[model samples]
Target: MKKMFNYYSDKYLASWIIKFLDLIVVFVGFVLASLLRFNFEVAGMSLSKLLEQSLITCAVYLVIFSLSKTSDLVMRHTSFTDIHGIFKAVVFSLAILIGMDVFLYEGMDYTGVFLIPKSILIIQALLVMLGISGYRLAAKSIYATFLNSSSALKSNVLIVGADVSSLMTKSTLLNSSKHSIRVIGHVDNHPKLQGKKLDGSPVFQLDNVINSSFLKEKGIDEIIISDATLGPAQKRAVIDSALQYNIKVREVPPHEKWVNGELTENQIKPVRIEDLLGRSEIKLDSINIQNELQGKTVLVTGGAGSIGSEIVRQALFFKPKKVIALDQGETPCYELGNTLKKLPEDIAAKCEIVIADITHFRRMQQIFSKYKPDLVFHAAAYKHVPLMENNASEAVETNVFGTKNIADLALRYKVQKFVMVSTDKAINPTNVMGASKRVAEIYVQALNSQQNSTHYIVTRFGNVLGSNGSVIPLFQKQIEKGGPITITHKDITRYFMTISEACNLVLEAGSIGNGGEIFVFDMGESVKILDLAKKMIQLSGLQEGKDIDIEFVGLRPGEKLYEELLAVEENTLSTHHPKIMRAQIQPVVSDEVKVLMDRLHEKVLHGDDEGVVGGLKQLVPEYISKNSVYSRLDKKSSQAYA
Candidate 1:
């Protein structure tokens, strides 16, 4: 019994001990085979007669097992390769046994004396294979059970699904001896899997799993979700319930993120805010987008920025003739080049990164003159609200003057479509950044005409989760620093989308637009910043106010408590796509928009920020400043209106 159970150790059983055990099994198997072959006629097979043949059989198998190194593998971790080793040993031993059984010693007159008779050798071979495999399998199963029940230090983790993925995750965690984790059970709602036993653990329903008191009973320290098909909403629900129960929850990393293309225990991590966005996958009108961009030379201003870079990446898939990644930042432009080079050589070669400023008319004109782009995506602007509030003139220079240059050049060069990347903040603007973008939106929307060859389109969206300087990254860094995660206000809320999803809709909306359309994306439900901060803390495996803290910093200049996607007088009409809509708002004419842009441009040229703010109010009458010095301009404009 000790020989049988000694295989359940931290290290592998000794090869010599393994050989001794295998020979013992071979000797016993031959005796059992002799009884079965002779119909249990033990009188003919006396112990004295069997002893000599059993020793010879054990010696032959011992030699075969040594030569094949069949005992070199860990019995408790036996795989098919180890089983194959046993098969080779069995066949080689059988070859020697058959030779001895058939050999006729004519000189000694022993032709009838068969050593370990032919019938017994055949029966023993069948018995040996079954016994060897059964021994290893029993060892493996017992070792697993021993590890599950014997270790008081091991953590008990409950798996969140009963699928193939969950099985793999369970095997990975259980096999990692360093982690010392025992999977308590699986939680899933599939009707077929319910009440089923996986690795001797129950597969229970996920409905009210946290409330079931099963976790407390089992002393489950963590919950691991490994189901790939589980929707984001379902995942968030599980995570939320687990957090409330003080049960740490982690998700198995996607297969692609596995290190060296193999899953490991360390790779599993807590689900991030990005994972819970629950954003539906955006299905693109790829054929329509291809028809619009195929063989067309495209220009993406601010191509190094978040949204601009993503558009460039997606647009290349449509087989554009050439894509010009125009941005002023030399470093980002170089980085973008390196990124583009990772694509197929053909697509990478079709891309060119130009270091140029959109605000400089001569530079942009030179680009427009040389490439004569058929389509342009303008993503460059001063987007930081607080920073722009302090530097209103600079925002006007880039957002206003830069936009005018791109629109005029697109019109002059007869570009098919010009898509301007706008923000939801542009609607009913309350900040200099939003007002500047609104001014640009007015300019671009005004430039589109019935007879004009160029069609100006605007795609407006809310915050993208992983964009540079976005809230999610900010909270992550703060949590990493082990400090207070700062929020402008507890009640403040914002809409969010993934960077890829936002850019996909941009491409989709650009393909389907005619001209003079401000397209708004369906940015799903808003998220409260305070709640977002708390979740980030929990995901970091830290308790709020104990391991970390959430600091409510007052709202910054020009920051609003709530974000709006459409203005008070404006509503959206659905397009062919469910997520995209055309804003039904009054469009300004070119002549009128040109006059206000000229005044804003003159103020920008004179470095008169106040005059620029005043001009912006005149351009967008609904522009109301909030918690900003520019709020005085709202009053001034309102008085003038009165």
Candidate 2:
């Protein structure tokens, strides 16, 4: 029977039937009002006059209802907006009817008999509104109750907030026929709301005593957090407590993510490890960044990669005159172009994608000559530690020569600012990738010393959470496969930040850097790889030792147990921004740097792997190889210097 009702309710015939029923209800309300006004004496009122008044009332209501389209709304999903529509239609229809009665009576009165008394008309309007609104509200209530009570596989839920968003979330869940989760109660931090009731559900204050026993007593199978006001630490605490009880935990995104200004059950998602990192939101100087980028032709290399693509997105926010995203990857660069094409017409008109390698000097020179970009963000480089260890020449060619190409062209084109993205691995480097980046840093710093129009800046930070080779995505894939998760070492750790945060700070650093300054971001704290793996397994609702196995493979070539942000010889000075600091290192002589780079470039071009490693050691004195084939060169360099 319910299925049949649902099927017919969606047909066009149902809408017309509802409209016809509404007219009959309005007509009856008018006649009933007249009977009541006459003290239940039908003889006191002329039956013909009452019938004529009923027709007029029904006609007016039909016109007004059509205009408001109140009958077009589904009865089962009716809300306050629908009720408001019905009220407006009824009041407007009666107001016009009263005006017509007064106008005709004053102008043309044949027998001096009134169509409807003013008091009767007012009573009729109220009756019509209630008749229409009450039925819809009752239908919605019945449907929600049926959905909640009829399900046999329902899971008891506890909401973590008692505010407006939580209320909406509960309503959405209750109204959804496909969902079987029943909200049992609310948990809030406010003492005043401890014993209060939200829609007849009791609210309890959260305390430290919450545990598996408390959850079991409440019969809670899941906890849904819908409060954006709670800090990360508080949310983490709730998640941790819920996880201990083996109860599923989910969270709603910020209000801005709601579709069409309405929350849906699908928007609730499981909590992620990034939420537990406890990093505060970054505050950027938008006006300063806009002033530096607006109406300027900007270029971002590696713009198809993670950090580079984010830099492109941020640059578009500043309304640059033209943003040229240059990357060597054909597929990703094409995808970036498609993404930009879907942006607002005005914003998309200002973006251009180029598939060109940064190592090709002639191609880069052409780009610089044609566009003459006013600002350049250099992010192209080979970054895999183990991969670069075997192919050291490729690392030098891309990280070193690629950066040098862009920096030189920026000088020749007289660009205003040049920002090179570096890594924390560049500090006291132990890997070929890091050493190559450090060498590029030295050259850019040395170039800044020469009289030039470009203000060269370098922003260095640690590992980004979901970048190309980051461990988070790898762990996620392994967990999905339900197999052994591999770790390089149990004690390995690295500083982490979101890609968005890192890019925002990079732009901030670019705006504030004068010249020859390496800006290091405050990457909150280093996370243990072993602990991260365990938390990931827990998040996936699997046991570490039983459901999944974590195998510790010894450290890879050129890999270290820890990463550094600053070298021993480099000291940092506080900057205007809280999260950013300036690294002050001994200046490199430009003449000496030029001679060494030329020699290193020759070796790299000739494919002399040994000579390239030898030149890298000579350039960066602190570039000691660790568990790599290049370790032999460290001994050779020490002996040569001695």
Candidate 3:
């Protein structure tokens, strides 16, 4: 039964057969009208005359319909436009019959030519309209039933909005022969749409929680969000409610992303954790960035890493003279080269790949002297907390010494701007990684104080979503392995920004900075790791305790429960861009910073882990070690001072 009307079995009658059926309707309508006009007294009627007149009526209807080509339309797909064509054909045929009747009134008086009465012809027109409209509607409804009942339609769904786009989305989803999903109804919070019907389905309340009974009653196993006006908070609420019932949720791509102005099944994507962050798109200070980067050669040090790579990609849009992607990772640089090959030929030619370690001052200096980059973005660093706690010397080697190497060479080569990417952990340092970054920041700021040739800028932001070794990917792997998801602490919270947004703001900060300024990005709200774990479990269609367990391990070495964007002693001054802020810090003279770095480098040369970490703490007095072997150093320093 399902196959008979589905797309595979979509067959329509031949045009000749449909024309014959239409003529039969016309003949039957005329006979029925004659019978009704004569009060069913067939004996008083002239049977031979009635037969001739019915044939004439059929011929007239057929000519008009054939001329209008109404029968060529598929009955199963008949629309309002098709029905209107039939109505026009019927009225036109009626008018022609009326004209014949008027001219042959004398013949009717003689009871010889045109024997049918005008009253009978009028009634026949009404009957023809009803008959033509009824069967086409019946065919269309039957085909719809077959499609809805097909085995291909496996899931019942609710569209997210009750608007014109939602209605169009419903029709597109259901009407497409290739789609396997069925739209059960629409969901909206508009009070005006409550208790109302869209198409033949009822609009359900949006905020109501989905219970088992309601799920069974509505047969809702999925929902497709198509509403552009629905905010992130609203989307998160719906997603949470749907996941409670194990109902799958998907979202439609924005209309601008539609393929060739039409929606495709491949374009409807699954909801991602990033969308739940509820932050709007940042309005980048593009004018400032463009004016700064245009026609200038730029260099990004960690150019293959997440933040660095995004910077390279977005920078190409500003039509720079050239971009040098300098990274030590051979494989990542190669892969980035392949990806860049997919860009326009002219743009692809603008990027130059180089493999060099930033810790080597001569290698960096050589590159800077050759390319003479007008602007430089220094992003490479060791960011992991526990690993850096154990390898304090190595952290200082890359994050501090590497940064100083780049900054010193930038000054030598007369680079226009040097932007260093720093993390929020640098604000109130608890880990060796954070301490090293803070020391690097201090060195750059101090260098900026003494220099007027090259401006040194520091852009500080929090963790970026889906960066290497981030929590979200960690939980995803644990979930895939079907076991407990490990978190440091239940109350631990951290700020997050999407990688693209953070890098764009970095460019904005680089554009607006003159010299020696630390720009802090607004990281919106901090999300609780405990809540994030639960949401991930639910999103995977599993219960936390029932299907998989969530284990709260104690905090790792040098890890903190909360991350801060600003130190207590530091305050921020507003920038032209609302999302970026310039931090006001007490300045250190160039001589003092140079002395401290020289001592730190000497300790690094002697491979003294303790001495290197001790020097970093002395530089940033706020630095305090936690849950690590380095905490002993803090104890010794306090005891000696006391």
Best candidate according to TM-score: 2
lDDT of 2 at 329: 99
The C-alpha stretches of model 3 lying farther than 4 A from their native spots are 1-144, 147-156, 162-182, 188-198, 202-220, 241-246, 256-266, 638-642
Alpha-carbon local distance difference test for all models: 0.85, 0.87, 0.85
Candidate 1 vs candidate 3: the TM-score winner is 1
- Per-model C-alpha RMSD: 6.1, 3.6, 8.6
lDDT of 3 at 178: 61
Across 1-642, the per-residue lDDT of candidate 2 in tens digits comes to 656645654544377778998988898888878877888898677788788778878888999999888789667777655787788888898899888778777667623444467888998898888877877777778777766655668989898889988888887777776776778898888988878999889897776325336777887888888888887778878877877777788888788998766787789888888877657789999999999999999999999998998899889989899999999999989888888877888888888899999999999999999999999999988999999999989999999999999999999999999999999999989999999999999999999999668899999999998899889999999999996999999999999999999999999999999888999999987999998888888878888889999999999999999999999988999998999999989988999899889989998988887788788888898999999998988776443421
List where candidate 2 sits over 4 angstroms from the true fold.
1-13, 16-43, 46-52, 59-74, 79-125, 190-192, 206-217, 545-547, 638-642
Worst 10 residues of 3 by lDDT: 207-216
Better of 1 and 2 by lDDT: 2
- lDDT for predicted candidate 3 compared with the true structure: 0.85
TM per model? 0.81, 0.88, 0.75
Model 3 clash pairs?
none
Number of residue pairs clashing in candidate 1, backbone atoms closer than 3 angstroms, sequence gap of 3 or more or interchain: 0
